[model samples]
Structures are given as structure tokens and as C-alpha cells.
Target chain A: DVKVTQSSRYLVKRTGEKVFLECVQDMDHENMFWYRQDPGLGLRLIYFSYDVKMKEKGDIPEGYSVSREKKERFSLILESASTNQTSMYLCASSFYGETYEQYFGPGTRLTVT
Target chain B: ELKVEQNPLFLSMQEGKNYTIYCNYSTTSDRLYWYRQDPGKSLESLFVLLSNGAVKQEGRLMASLDTKARLSTLHITAAVHDLSATYFCAVSVAGNQFYFGTGTSLTVIP
Candidate 1:
């Protein structure tokens, strides 16, 4: 079984504070993704990394960035958290090719006040 | 812009009934996936349809894809309360990237 774990299951931060959400996968997958899920809007991609030090912006990347310094870990960074940034953050990983089914971690519900 | 859309955003049905959730994508892609997410939990991969006319089933849930139509269907047979969850369909694009639908929240009333 593949295991994807997040650093935090819940978090709270004040406005303009820096926040980091971390994800680690044991499957050694090459592709990692960050997504924010909101009610009615579903899961929107924020950023993705294909390889170490390689990152790409997804549809909703504003105010957020990602780091992939190692193959097993991916981190999502909020430059300065705002109330609007409060969301359930999900991290997923998949193999580079063939099957692209993503394995998701337990999400982090971030609250910004 | 690439888009993946699912219909009947909210569904309520009685146990033992049948229903299907539809997923439509805006681009041409042969690989589609189905996932189930329980409340307050991560998503669990359900099915992967790799080509047109591909179908996969597990227990009460079945998923099929039609590449030409850019659509996928998740059919629930004899719906059970345990089957209630938010279902999402995703289409693979540019090889590694995926566009996910808004999801269909299903509730099976006992």
C-alpha cells in the first residue's frame, strides 16, 4: 500500500503570517501536486513538481508556491497567509508515466484569521 | 482552458436504488480516473479507464469511459449508505497533469 502523509492535519494562522504545509510519500513517485479543495469548487491544483527542483504553476497558484528539494517530500508555502487562503490543502503523488492515478495524503485544514 | 465537469452536483437517493454520475472533459484524452472521498478524509482511487469503451467495476460501483465523447460515467448499483461520498473524475492532460471535475456529492439514505 502507498502512504502519503502530511505534516499537519489542522493549522491556524493570523493574517500576513507565513505558512507551510508539508507532504511526504513513501512510494517514491516522481510527480507531486498541491491542491486546495473548496466547497462546490472541488479540488483545484495550486502547484506541482515533476522532479526535484522542478515546479509548475497549476490553475490556482496565486499567493502560493511549492518546493520539491527531494523526491519524497513536497512543501507548499503561502507567502503571506490571508483569510481567503484558508482551505483544505491536499497533497498527492503519482508515478511519472503509464498509470497517473494519484495517491492523496490526509488533508490539512488551514484556518487564517 | 481545460475543463472537467461533473453533473448532478448533489444527489440523494434511497438505498437499493441506482444512479450514475456523469463526468465530461473539454479536451481529448483517453485516460480518466474515478475517486471517492469521505467526509474529512483523503481521496481513494476507485477506477482507471484507459481507453474508449473501457469499463471497470468493484462491488457496487462501475466506471466507464468513452474517449470520443470525452466523458466518463460512474454507475452505482443497489446504492448503499456506505457508498455515500463525494466522487470526482479526473482527466489526464499533457501526460502528467490532470484536470479534475467539481465532484458529485452523493448521499444514500437508508
Candidate 2:
């Protein structure tokens, strides 16, 4: 079975705090992505990595960054957490060549206070 | 930039009723996907339509893609409470990059 795991199911952070959300996939996929889900706005991509040490910004990557030190792990970082950043974050992984069909993790619901 | 749109952002139906959710993309793309997300949970891949006139069905749900029209439809037959969830359609314009629609929240009332 394909599995994707997130570091936290729910997280609480204070304003200005640095936060890291980790995602790991056991399927050995080459593509990983991060998206934030907000009501009425849907899921907006934050960042994605196609390979180790290779990352690209998505449509809404202004306040976020990503790290891919290893093939199995992709991390999303918030340099300064703000209340407006509170939302459900989803991580997904897919094959390098086939990026359309992706498997998603359980998601991390982050609350920035 | 690619944009995906879903109509009737909210849908409410009784048990044993039928309905359909429409997903439309702004640009040309043959790869499309449908996902179901339960409340407070992650999304699960439901269908992947890669070509024109591709139709896939599982249990009570059926999905069809019309690449020429840049449209996809998810049809629900005799929906039950268990089918209640948020449905999202996504389109891929490039390798590993997708644009998701606004999503449709469906509630199957008993």
C-alpha cells in the first residue's frame, strides 16, 4: 500500500514563531508537493520538489519555503507564523514522470496564534 | 496560468438521490483527477481521467472526461451518508504540477 505521513496532525504556533511541517512517503516517489486548504479558496500549492535538493515555488509561495534533503522526505517551513496562515496543509507524492496521479498524506491542521 | 473551477460549491441531497458535480478547466489539459476529502481528513484519489471520453466508475460514483470541452463530471447514484464529503477536481498543465478547483461540498442527508 502507498503511504504518505505528515509530522503533525494538528499544530499550534505563536505569531512570529518558525514552524516546520514534515512529510514522508514510503512509496519512493520522485515528486512531492505542499498545498494549503482554505475555505472558498480551495487548495493552493505552496511549494513542490521534483528531486532531492530541487524545489520550485507554486502559485502561493510568498510566505513559505520548502526543503528536500532526501528523496523520501519533503518539508515545508514558515519563517514567521501568522494568524492568517492558519489552515490545513496537505502533502502529496507522485512518480517523477507521472505527476497527475498523486497520493496524499493525512494532512496537518496548523493554527497560528 | 491554469485555473480549475467547480460549480455548485455546495450540494445537499437525500439518501437514494442522484446528482452530478461539474469541473471545468481554463486551459488545455488532458490529465485530470478527482479526489474526495472527508471532514478533518486528507484527500483520497478517486479517479484519474487522462484522455478524452474516458469514463471510470466505482461503486456508486462515475467520472467522465471530455478533453475537447475541458470538462469533467462526477456523477453520484443513490448517494448515501457515507458519500458525503468534499470533492475536488484537479488539472495538470505541467509535469507534477496541478491546479485544483474550488471544490464541492456534498452532504447526503437522511
- Give the per-residue lDDT of model 1 (tens digit) for A1-113: 99999999999999999999999999999999999999989999999999999999999999999999999999999999999999999999999667788999999999999
- After superposing candidate 2, which stretches have Cα over 4 Å from the reference? A97-99
| Residue ranges of candidate 1 with Cα displaced over 4 Å | none
Residues B27-101 of candidate 2 have per-residue lDDT tens digits of 989899999999999999999988899999999999999999999999999999999999999998775788999
Consecutive 10-residue window with the lowest summed lDDT within model 1 chain A = A95-104
lDDT of 2 by residue, A38-70 (tens): 999999999999999999989999889999999
Collision pairs in model 1: none
DockQ of 2: 0.78
lDDT against the true structure, each candidate: 0.94, 0.94
Q: Provide the lDDT at A60 for model 1.
A: 92
Where is model 2 chain A poorest over a 10-residue stretch in terms of lDDT? Answer: A94-103
Per-candidate RMSD vs. true structure?
A: 0.7, 1.0
Best by TM-score: 1
Cα-based lDDT at residue B70, candidate 1: 86
